[model samples]
Target: TEGLVMAKNSSAADQLELIALAVRGNVSLALAARAVRSAVEAGEYEAIARALADQAGRNDPLQPRDRALAATVAAELSRLGSKAAPLWQVAREAWELERSAWWLAYALFREAEALLSAAGKRDAARDVLVRARSIARLLEAAPLLAEIDALAGRGRVDLGSPSPQLLDPVPDRKLPISDREMEVLVLIAKGLTNKEIASELFISERTAAHHVGHIFDKLGVSNRVEAASVAHQAGVLVEDT
Candidate 1:
């Protein structure tokens, strides 16, 4: 229940914690999946995508378990119409490099789902699944083969186009500030000192100062005053009425 609540809150960090708990036998896989789905729905797509990318980058050859998990998450994001193309590419490359047939088949199945659900490329999706089925058959992966068959049997159903709000363009003058760092910048704009900002954000003053330094570096500013000015000029800060 706590896991579900955390999922409902859409905190990517909390969802990742829930996943760790699942790996430790403290939570169910279903609950973890729900939490991840909720986080994606809540616009935590970049966090999840970044996490998957980090995981893919950690292992040189990409362990089978890691590859499977990354592929599964990428596929689920695709099903939810998230921009998971990069994640899919990472999984595909890892599998190809390792020559792991079973995981490759699994990744292919998910890649097909991404193609169909996210990109709306039906013919391409079918071709991907066809290749997955071939690999599954060759490796005697019965479960994967069954899944491919079921997907093929269902035919195409509209999953609805992605929402325009989800397609909002990144700012041309986007700084490298992280989401938390942006929050720090907002507080700075409000004229909050580092100690006050730390209190407001429930972090230590040292941490707040660290974020301020990062904000300065990312925004190409030297001090809080300059950072605040740049934030306002860049339309990154909202003014009070």
Candidate 2:
């Protein structure tokens, strides 16, 4: 889990650099996947989402290999046990932007599983899986279809026909805090001092203080406790289990 450790400590820009290097053949896809997995596990969710969105929004289309890699990263995020909603949102956005029906279906499938397993919304989850199954059929993706069948069999849930709106992308909402600021906020919530946050995030104490100041301003709070309160209320921080 060296990659995971590195990703937890590195800045978002450094993580993106690793991805770029992978794309340019300076690093292996395995390393790229590790970086992506690490980012997801480290809760650098917004950073990953924004990077994928930016790539998707580019006028120049992504190469097939890059698209596949992006899809892989999205899929990995979708499978996370916690924070699945945000991750699935990012994955859905990427697949929709790419117009990859199969990948979109897969993303839906994972979201449904997360809903069922993590959130305990069985009926809603089944509905989403139904949407995924329909898309898989339309694309003639036998593997995806088979996986859907397996999921249905295992869950013993009767899936209905797809709802027309089930696969539609949710509108993107902007967060008040930047990704770097969010990282600082999370560490602050953990009761880390500025020096500690700096060490954890691999930045200077002065830079960490600067980020803390920005976070306080953006959140309209004067201290770490108030900042954590605002972040929790805003749903920026995951609920404690």
TM-score against native, each model: 0.40, 0.41
- Look at candidate 1 and give me any clashing residue pairs: none
How well does candidate 1 match the true structure in TM-score terms? 0.40
Residues 1-241 of candidate 2 have per-residue lDDT tens digits of 2333455567998866655544454234344556666777888755555454444334332454455446446545444335565556556666776778888898888777666554357787788888889899899998878777656643445776322221112234244777667768877887889998765554668989999999888878899999877655555554433
lDDT of 1 by residue, 1-241 (tens): 3444555566788777765554543323344456567777787766656555565465433345555566556545544446655567677777887788887788777777666544356777777777888899898888788777655543332223221121123477576777667778878988999998765554668988999998888788889889888777766664442
TM-score of 2: 0.41
RMSD of each: 20.0, 19.5
- Return the lDDT, model 1, position 225: 89
Off by over 4 Å in 2: 1-81, 161-241
